[model samples]
Target chain A: MEELLAEVVNVLVVIVEACGAAVIIIGAVWAFARFAWVGFRQRTTAAFVPVRLTLGRFLALGLEFQLASDVLRTAVAPSWEELGQLAAVAAIRTALNYFLSKEIAEERRQVAAEQDHHEVTSTDHRGSGV
Target chain B: MSAVAEVTRLAALGTGLAAVVAGALALVVTRRPLPALAVLLDLLLAAGLLRLAGDPDWQGIVTAAAIVALRHLIGVGLRAGGRAWTGPRPPAASAQEKSAL
Candidate 1:
């Protein structure tokens, strides 16, 4: 029974790890395609907002899955080496997530500010009959 | 090795699969990534719970939970920033109305 359970656990871990990797790969590819399409359409920094936002979101999610898988892989029987590796991976991913989120927030603010400015200018022009 | 460990691994796999599918849908079909992002964060919390099922390691589970919470906090802050940016616009008035006033 113990052996059977270990086999089951090992299979489950493999499946989860595989799925996590697949998700990351697919998400990265899809995000890249979308970003390229956007870039092709408009070459301006402003035009890249959607691409950055979308890609950042996808990457962030993929990183989280990757992190979760790492945690699971080490949860059952963590050696010192495995624990050390997990710590390093977690730190790197956490840092990436933080910066990506910061950039996304900044872009969102810029977009909102631009839209508001546009609206105000349009309103002024209409009021002036110009 | 143990039943608990097996269960934890199974839960992680299940949640991992769900996160992947939700992420794909957000990227392709719906084009709405925020909710999917939230779902992914939620999955982190679930993964943390599953971790507890195996070996009572506070470090891993706590880290996962902290990440999820931090994400939510950041999201709230960003939304607040957006609102602040858009909050100060004056209402529009017609030329005739402005001249009369």
Candidate 2:
């Protein structure tokens, strides 16, 4: 039984190493695409990031629900540290997304307010000219 | 193939499929892709961490660090890209001015 355990362990080690290497390569490709593409980032943020944050704010309870599910899943059969890492990733992504969305909203509100101010001043100037 | 080997192969398949899908979707769906592109990176990182969890090694930790760095880079790109995309559209007169110049 010990021998069998060691064999599986060794295989898992190789598998993990393989996966890690692949992720590194994937990161590189992502970096490359972001740089190589023209104007790809512009369209994505307008449509998605805010949408993500708005959903995230509403999904707070759902997150707790997910945590409960994760705890149960891990408790039943301890899969690996990967699940923990994935959870970490999810948390970081969501938190960062929340902050970013807040910033974007702030900027939009400012711009809109300015536009309204500009319109009011322009109309006032026209009345004086007439 | 042994179960361990099969698992590894499956992980490989998953990573490849995710990269392709994410990249393609990013190209099709948005003008600003920095954030969505990060999803692809996350998927790859998840695969690595998942495998490492089973394997438990130093290399896995290193991989995680690299992935984080990439995520940061994407955040930076998104900031820059958002500014450019959202820059106020020049009034039509400016377009005519440029055409004259």
Identify the leading candidate in terms of DockQ. 2
DockQ of each: 0.04, 0.09
Model 2 scores a TM of 0.37
By TM-score, the best candidate is 1
Error of 2 at A9 (Å): 21
lDDT of 1 by residue, A30-85 (tens): 54455445445543435445654665576567566656665666545437865765
Lowest summed-lDDT stretch of 10 residues in model 1 chain B?
A: B48-57
lDDT of 2 at B90: 70
Worst 10 residues of 1 chain A by lDDT: A39-48
Candidate 1 lDDT: 0.57
Model 2 share of native interface contacts: 0.11
User: TM-score, each model?
Assistant: 0.50, 0.37
lDDT of 2 at B99: 93
